[model samples]
Target: MRRFFYTIDSDNADAPLLPKLSELSQGSDIELPDSIIHHWCRVLRANVGDQGILFDGFGGEYQVQLQTISKKKAIATLLLHLDDDRTAPIISKIGLVMSRGERMDYAIQKATELGVTAIQLLSSHHGEVNLKPAQVEKKLAHWQQVAIAACEQCGLNRPPLILAPLSIRDWLAPTESPNNKTAVSPIVSTLSKDKYYQVLESAADLRLQMSVPAAGQPAKPEILETVLKQESPYIELLIGPEGGLSDDECQKAESVGFAPWQIGTRVLRTETVPVVALTTLLALYSYNK
Candidate 1:
């Protein structure tokens, strides 16, 4: 079934009276985004008295009846507070190096569709395009459109948060948030003097960038799984560019204690590692689920 979710203003309580009146009651007026208005009002042929889902994050979904309609305006009133059917357990987040051209777009779309909760774009030393503020804003807007399109197609009602543009270095530095949020860095590795991976870490769990070699001639998957077992409490993937991390960058990462382990006998593309890492952890986490 096609599913859509929206938040309703609690001050308006007429939504709950829909079923009793047998007519949709138009309540709070919300400004629908242009693209959505086109689709919902025109393409979907959604008219007054039609049903949809609306809710607060309070865990119950409000079954709503569409109350009013016009060329560019519509509203839905809450009907029944139905419990949600699906649940997403994994709190997956990706920290990606900005790839050039359409590849970055493709990665973000795929990653969001795959259920990433947040997407953080990082500019690494190996990044190909240097951005001015305007350029970054332009790209972020495009990226958000891509995410919304993915949500529409993938049935993801809750859109993932797209973080502000940041560099690998600046993103790693500690700072205060308006919400009184604590410092959070996701990328981690095993300790190794040679391989560079640790451009990101947290004070509580500082050992994220190390790669652990297996006890025997283990499979690549097996080695990664064993290594993740020793993960320092959190897992934030740090993916480098096509040319890979620079020697100096790698050395700097290593100085902060990144464990560099081999993924395979062959080299993976810039976009491939993070995808694999996401799937791998999801699979591992699913086993316990």
Candidate 2:
């Protein structure tokens, strides 16, 4: 069946309320938001009896049939709740240095499609783009929308959490308590050697450094594969912007336990690294299983 997925904004209480997956049963009528109604009626030219899927972003999804369609609103009747879990077994978070325009948007979309659990926008010394406080708020919302759109298209019921942009220094700052947040393996892309060995030795979680190596140097996918074998439930990948991380920034990351690692021999663009790295990690995960 052609499954069209729509995400319900649980935060928007003003919208028509839909039953939770646990409370949902067959033959219950539910009203879809006007935005979804417009897409179905105006964009897709869906008829009254068209069928699609609805996900609340909690987990799982529902089979729904369009029972009523009009210029103002549309209603669907919930048929069944499919308890399929589509979440990735390994949680991946990408800490990306802000890039220009569509490049950042593309990274967020593709990363969500690759099943990243969260995205942290970071500012680096070498990054080309800078945002004021207002711009940060706006960009955070924009990137979040991009993630949601990616989820709707890619069959991900849960979208990655989009964090507000922070400077690289602030991002690496130690929190007062480690138990306050979920544990994550920290991997960073760098070429620094000063603290590399120490970071690797002390790393309790999987840490990666992605770099394009010099000629005759071996690729480190094998190293990344070995780290993945450690089976950390969550990993946070750090990729730099434009010119990549500066020397000082690399040192700071290493101080925070971000082990550096390289991918292939060729340099990947700022936006391209997330897609390539995520695909490699996900592929390695499946291969190991």
Candidate 3:
């Protein structure tokens, strides 16, 4: 069976007949999202009785069977709901600097596959890509779609929220108290509206920066082991750009409680940091548990 992300456009009158997943029941008909129609109906040439999986960025996925197909529209019937949760044992949001072209996409894709809770897109002193005011919406949409496609391929039911890009300085500024809860990302708030996704807005239990390998830096942060002991520990990671964060930026990050985490002696490219750092974290989490 193929998989499709069921998107709802509450403001669009032409949205699918079943706009909300709550409206779905076994044997009930659901008008497939437009994106799915193009890929499944026209491109794949799907036929009646074809089965596929569907997830709405909620907690679980659904098994559906195509009942009707056309050049412009398609319909599927919900077969069953699978309540399997494959989220990471530790909750994480990477403050990833935006790189150019495929590098950015690759980082987001790998992060999604690793069950990241969210990605806070950042523009650092040496970051390459900076969206103009006119470009923000388009780029955000493109990146969000990138995350959605990654979820479809990786079997992650809850797509990590791709937050709007922010300056590293602003992102590091302590706006909220450690105990204060911040507001959810506008993107997730508009599309998801789920309590599960809201957890990303809360203060992280531990914060780490993927620091450049230096002689004196510890291989890993000391607090990481203690933090991973908690149930569903929320961690925030700061990864710099290719040229890396300036000395001033690094200082600010440290002042705000981001412990320096040096992976190894070799320097890693901006795109590779997330994969290596996340894999290391997952390994540590599994071993500690």
Q: Pick the candidate with the highest lDDT.
A: 3
On TM-score, the candidate that comes out on top is: 3
Scanning candidate 2 in windows of ten residues, the lowest lDDT window is 183-192
Task: State residue 66's C-alpha deviation in candidate 1, in Å.
Answer: 2.7
Q: Candidate 3, overall lDDT?
A: 0.83
- Tens-place lDDT per residue, model 2, 1-289, is 3344354333354544444544667888877766577666788898988888877566678888989887888889988888887777666767899899899899999988888877778888989887896676567767877877787788887667776677777777736434333221111111112231122223235645555555654565345566666554466688998788888988877777676767766788989998998888888877876
Can you give the lDDT of residue 285 in candidate 3? 86
lDDT (Cα, tens digit) per residue for candidate 1, span 108-221: 777767666566677777788667866765676567657656765675654444555666665454252334222211110011111211222233232233122234533343
Clashes of 1: 18
Ordering by TM-score: 3, 2, 1
Task: Please report, in order, the local distance difference test score of every candidate based on alpha carbons.
Answer: 0.52, 0.69, 0.83
Q: Which scores higher on lDDT, 1 or 3?
A: 3
Error of 3 at 232 (Å): 0.6
At residue 202, what lDDT does model 3 achieve?
81
TM-score for candidate 1, residues paired by index = 0.65
Q: At residue 130, what lDDT does model 2 achieve?
A: 74
